[model samples]
Target: MSYDKEVGLRMNWPMIVYISLVHIVACYSIYNTITRPHYMLTYVWTIILWFISGFGITAGAHRLWSHRSYKARYPLRVLLMIFNSIANQGSVIHWVRDHRLHHLYSDTDKDPHDSQRGFFYSHVGWLLVRKPKRVLDAGRKISLNDLYKDNILLIQHRLCPWWNMLWCFIFPAIVGYYLWDESILNGILLPGVFRYCFVLHATWCVNSVVHQWGPKPYDNKSHTTENGIVAFIALGEGWHNYHHTFDWDYVTAEMGAIKQYNPTKVFIDIMYYLGLAYNLRRAYPKGWEHLKSRNIRKLGGEYHVVEGIYGIPPFCHRTVTYVQGEGGGGGRLLSETQVDNMSTTDEEGL
Candidate 1:
């Protein structure tokens, strides 16, 4: 496969060094975990911080900010911004910029994490290497007007260095020293470095494993797919095929029910009940059926349609246009009239 443009690789020494140190310290922390079993408080703190930081990326950077799947209140935005710094992925502004471009130009050289490049490059190697020129150029073409207008994102981006130090290191160490009565060095290494590395790898799994493996129940035109393991660990981000097909849907997956492993969707629901989120966008069931019917890969018998979990009712009437054209000619359009009929047919068959 050829790309419209090519991006030569460059070394990002700072990122390389930072990642190397984190891994080294994380390995050392493993020894601490085995020998120092009395620091149960530190282990608990690591787990809590891991959840907060992971949610920060999945809920804040990916869904709310990158896709604008729903509107969040000011307080929710502030909370997400704080936790996002602890995640240490990057500033929300740059993170959102890269993500939007990845969706727009997926699998191409312009994509920030081009999965076609192979697992290592897509997983974390992209971060270690200097961003390709095409990525930067294509990112500029994306409209981040909404993100720029966001005061919370602006403040986080401006004070990112300070915030990262305070939340990712200083705060954790302080809590460990004062509250847990543990060595500050131990605090920094265990919960700080180890937790950060764990969350980082889990998030990266969605970019690498979910794309390279798993079932593509939705669209297969792209490399993205749905993986249950990644969804559980990434807090609902693993439904990559459904996400790419319906990017505006808040849940990122078709099944948003409580039984689903999408904790992020549940969190958004909680926010909605508390009036912290509104105008939640979701894919229409009829639209999903229309898309599924045209899917290059057929869904197996195990697949069944449920009332879309967003509480939106299925449309009784819908129109699907099939266009025929060659070389950009004005195509003839065919509209199917029996939209409800087709859905009923599918349901009865299921």
Candidate 2:
């Protein structure tokens, strides 16, 4: 009966049609690349561009802005802004607001992509259908005041439609037409449409595949899980159980998983070494082992994780050490107030 419960599915036909058309064209583009051997360069570019766009979401929107998992210098922030435009999922402010809401409310009716609504609903149906009243009401409580103050996010939010069209599709097509001597049509199909669609689905998997499969080691009582395959495809975000348990950790996955399939972690690490990123946070004060699958969350209660600049829930359960800079194993621990101020200062990066 729970599975059969109707949560209202008024269809947003335009969105449904657009998504369907994108998938069909993406499939055709894959076939086109195979048959047209000359499209080798375009194919390679598609893969490279996919990761570039994903960085915008995973690093720019999710980690840096949404969760405040780390802080980035102006140069890196600008670069990530450009990358997020290429990803074209949404503006950083909108994306972060939705993400924060998803975390605070999780799989309840308030969650935009509620996993209990079924895989298709979580994966894409939420977008294809008009949002229910509950979802809208839940979203209203989640504010974007912090995000709006950031000039970088504000500009991106204003021009996302125009710039996204340019970077996500038109620019890539132009490169194929001029640099690669590929047809504009093939360019749009291969790297433009196909890659855009590919990134969308892969990110969506975190909402669907991640919630359904894998182990819930950190908080067994929670709805999320850890899936290595999703992590690999998503550039390391698929450790949903760990992430939900320790949402403030900049690594998102396990502490010492740089060698694993978590390129997003490595990308942030590279930026840290280059002095482009700093003030990265770590797991909850007690780390994963202490949770021991305990229900660390209670509805509308304070989350028991480290607080970041962007979204610190009402309460934290303990006063233990939360590593900074490196993975959870080593690094100086900052008091809560220090962590909040670190993002704005010119302090030497770790």
Q: Estimate each model's TM-score.
A: 0.81, 0.79
For candidate 1, write residues 1-350 as lDDT tens digits.
57654445678899999889889988998887777753788889988888888879988999999999998999999999888998888799999898999998888888899999999999999998887777888888999899899998999899877777678877787888999698888888888888888888999998899889865545645688767778777888887888998999998887654544787888889999999989899885765876646421122233223222221222011123433443224644333222222443345423
lDDT, candidates in the order shown:
0.77, 0.77
- Which residue runs does candidate 1 get wrong by more than 4 Å? 3-8, 293-350
lDDT of 2 by residue, 283-333 (tens): 854675445222222111112344332112211112323344335445455
Using lDDT, give the best candidate's number: 1
Error of 1 at 203 (Å): 1.3
Candidate of highest TM-score: 1
After superposition on all CA atoms, what RMSD does each candidate show versus the true structure? 9.2, 11.3
Off by over 4 Å in 2: 1-9, 284-286, 292-350
